[model samples]
Target: MVTIEYIVDLVNKHNVWRGKECINLVASENVMSPLAKRLYVSDFMHRYNEHFEKSHYQGTKYCMEIEGFVKRIFGERFNTDKVEPRPLSGGQANLIVLAALTSPGDTIISVGLTSGAHVSHTKFGVVGVLRLEEKVAVNNEDLTIDVDATARLIREKNPKVIILGRSLVLFPEPIKELREEIGWDIPILYDVAHVFGLIYAGKFQEPFEDGADIITTSTHKTFPGPQGGMIIAKKDFPDKLWEKIYYTTFPGLVYNHHIHRLPALVVTALEMNAYGEEYATQIIKNAKKLAEELYDRGLKVLCADRGFTETHQILVDVRDYGGGAKVAEILEDNNIIVTKVALPWDTPKDATENPSGIRIGVQEMTRYGMKEEHMVTLAEFFDRILNRRENVRREVTVFRKNFQKVHYCFNNI
Candidate 1:
């Protein structure tokens, strides 16, 4: 029953269904550009660039050049001299940072998972694995950290480091306010996993200027690069710590470091430098438009008083429509892809299944050349599905057919 032909057919079938038909709205996903994906299949994928202080492998002249150039250019792009281009994913980058900085049983303040923090920032993930105690910053009603209270808590707790940024981020974190209270002693690591492209475009908040000393980011969410991660800091980041992070990334964590993604990362950074402003602005516009349109059609789009959102994502309280579990499945059945997430008030029972919200992101669709008007049509699709209980799978497929080209990049430009 199992054969190479069968495996190839499965891949082709998946491409046609997910790539050509479905309206992908996954918050943490993005497509590589035609150019980026082309280079992603390079010979470097077959090689290794394992190094610490110095490389352990040879025949890597081109690999050394590409990796070194990536480190230098991304350093310049983020206005920093320190960059660690290892860590296979965002979660791994977080681990490296914690390992280099915190010893076992140290305390780190993080945003609570129910309040939108990524799992790695919680005790349930890397913090617990490292034997670190994790305390959470107070979350305000709209899911932002309560600044003044968090400042007081930080002083009381005297945490070794505090982590900010969230998987469900809407507004920018109150980094400047927190910094004003806590001052420059403790390091604030802002995980820009979901918003790196926005910040890179200068569309979102500035990390260093806003008092964040470091950033750990996934390069593929809004960033449109190969799946990888980086740990970055300011120009004058403490040298000893930087050296530790470098070694920790090389021998301490990964060896090959997936040298293949480096080329695609460089290409994405170039494209982002050229057109990221337009791309980021469109993503936010599409999110807000989709939210307002969905709200008008009677869906409970959260944070309406705050103009829906400042980033690429919007959350809907879908408990009225058989909860987030059934709602997400129904949407998927109709070829409208999204993820269910826990709201601030979700019960522990609700958190795992039938949570209160469905998160929609416009970044992936924006990359595929969808715009504000298309968001209106998307809202109508949601209205028909959740409000009227109708199936729109065929219409969704036909709608997707018009927007296959990756936009705001050098694809066919």
Candidate 2:
């Protein structure tokens, strides 16, 4: 008979293998700081704090204060007095914003899948569910948005909103240039789900400064917070429109907003404020170094002429190593965790299964204190596993053991 301890054992198994042994390169994941993780197991997990301006129930006095404080902290940091922490996930936040801004069957523009747009921005996900028409913006050869082409498209289409930022990110989106070319009538919603922490660190483009009217992001990715979502609007955002977004979040989309993660989220926001710049800088350095090393090792690392990357992510065209699905499986077998994504050449249908590229991120490993030198060793592991057909699980586990501690946070300070 299976006992209750089996589930606990499975949890322990995952913690040991994924937490302590494997080198996690998945672009969309990270570990919370010790303080954040420790505080995560709180009495708040059993409660609810559903509110817009007023609570539907009692016992949320303290939670209200906690949520308000976090909102203010992020507001000041991101140069906005408008920040909504009520959406449970980044996708929900996007849905709330889209729902508030546009009616059903409205037309919007997002970068194509090949250019790194998230599924939530496409017809295969949120757009389809909401009955909105999504048009693809033009992208340049380097996989960055072509500002002139997009400007022409935008003028012709006159879309309701233009969503920026992407999943398989390498370079900054052409926000300022696109805004300048197209004029200011169209609102830009930048999804910084992959680069929230980098933006907070001042290491990437400023969404608001670059003409984004609003931003939707998960606090967990580069932000290193608990698994939750947030939306921030510019200082000059219309009060009426902000009210619409707020209402959409409460009566329209969200309910509890997962008050359990609020304390952890607040702790992570503080942690990001403390060490974000140093952490983001190191993540970029590691990404660039790893990309260069992989390219030098004959891996089809994209955008070598542009120095491979400027953020935590590196996209590798792994078709020669039997496509992204096979390469990701091979890397996982050897204790390296990564996700398969489609290159520009792959059709949308090919993205979900066997795409031509694998996207690697260094932020989590950087949080685990891996640096530029460590990237060389990691590149070697990739080369050995994918190129030489060697199983390096034992080697990866050994290397990972040394960097088990989470860095660039209050855990050390």
Candidate 3:
């Protein structure tokens, strides 16, 4: 059996041993709520119950209850007609949806990797590996998807599916306009791996209402749940689509999900229902604050005039800090964790080894109870480091020591 003492020691050793620590700005990350963690830790182990059980096993009654609870919660929050909570990860969700909707040779439109599109849709990742035809690109300005270009591409290539919502997307896409352009001949799928939780908490534009046919997301990111995947579809798809997803999730793909995580998924849904709105609002507020502070310090942050972001992420062109990897390294010296991102149009010359910018956000810190004021403080640290890299190194060592005092995850630090 597991012991609380053991868990507590692990949390202290791993999670909290650093100061002003873990301001992880990776937009695709969040601290899971305690309830979510509990659920993840206490799930039941089960055999392959291939389909949703009508008694595939004798004692799956409770499993059904929890699974149903997860479905119901997602149904109400996302307001989608169907929900599949069994994909092993967000990438699997995209794969199943694509398999269900498009044939191997059928064309799909998504953003290119440099443009912040996910690997699941781009030809470079699973989509490419799976032999799916794909067209991907970036916007001209504002760094979001370019609707006009998309329309032109759609008119010419006429892809069967269009996948929106890339990994680094901060502004809204042209889904409604694109839908009007396409007129339902082609279906649009939203890979909301980063923004679905924000949508659930009312911090993002709803793709379903805005004309998307389907949405796939990770349950963990902004939803702050267990690391799992979900696929939500409109009321119009035939039952076969769901069956395809169900089969792919079980025998077709994952054998059995982490049963313990089911409880966490259910509780995450509840927490999202309860405190999600406020949490999401504050997260955006924290992001905006961080961006503004960085800008005020004269940094070249993206989308400043356009509000830099409407979500919990901000990408800064840190070319002056000797590129992304160097900037990331300097920030790490200060106990501030962030990543280097390659801009949509960047190329091999802009790889992480020498990328053009740094990306940061407040999701993890926000989940840990920090706010706008904290954001400014964090930015100030970055400013000092960037402006005085050599001088701040020793100072940052002291700050790093203090970062260990704050609590973060419950176990495994």
What lDDT score goes with residue 201 in model 1? 91
Q: How many clashes in each structure?
A: 0, 0, 12
Over 4 Å off, model 1: none
What range of 10 consecutive residues in model 1 has the weakest lDDT sum?
Answer: 47-56
* Window of ten residues with lowest summed lDDT in model 2: 344-353
Model 1: per-residue Cα lDDT over 73-167, one tens digit each: 78888788898888899999999998989999899999989999999999889999999999989889898988889999999999998999999
Q: Give the clashing residue pairs of candidate 1, or none.
A: none
Q: What is the TM-score of each candidate against the true structure?
A: 0.98, 0.98, 0.89
Whole-model lDDT values for every prediction: 0.91, 0.91, 0.76
lDDT of 3 by residue, 153-173 (tens): 888998878888888878777
Winner of 1 and 2 under lDDT:
1
Candidate 1 has a TM-score of 0.98
RMSD list, candidates in order: 1.0, 1.1, 4.2
Candidate 2: tens digits of C-alpha lDDT, residues 1-413: 88899989999999999999999999999999999998888888889877768889799888888888888899889778899998888999899999999988889999977788988999888887889999999988778988898899999999999999889888888899998899899899999999998999999999989899999999899889899899999999999999999999988889877787888888888888888899999999999999999999999999999999999999999889889999899899999999998988897678777899999999999999998999999999988887789999999999999999999888654
List the candidate 2 regions with Cα displacement exceeding 4 Å: none
By TM-score, the candidates rank as: 1, 2, 3
- Top candidate when judged by lDDT against the true structure: 1
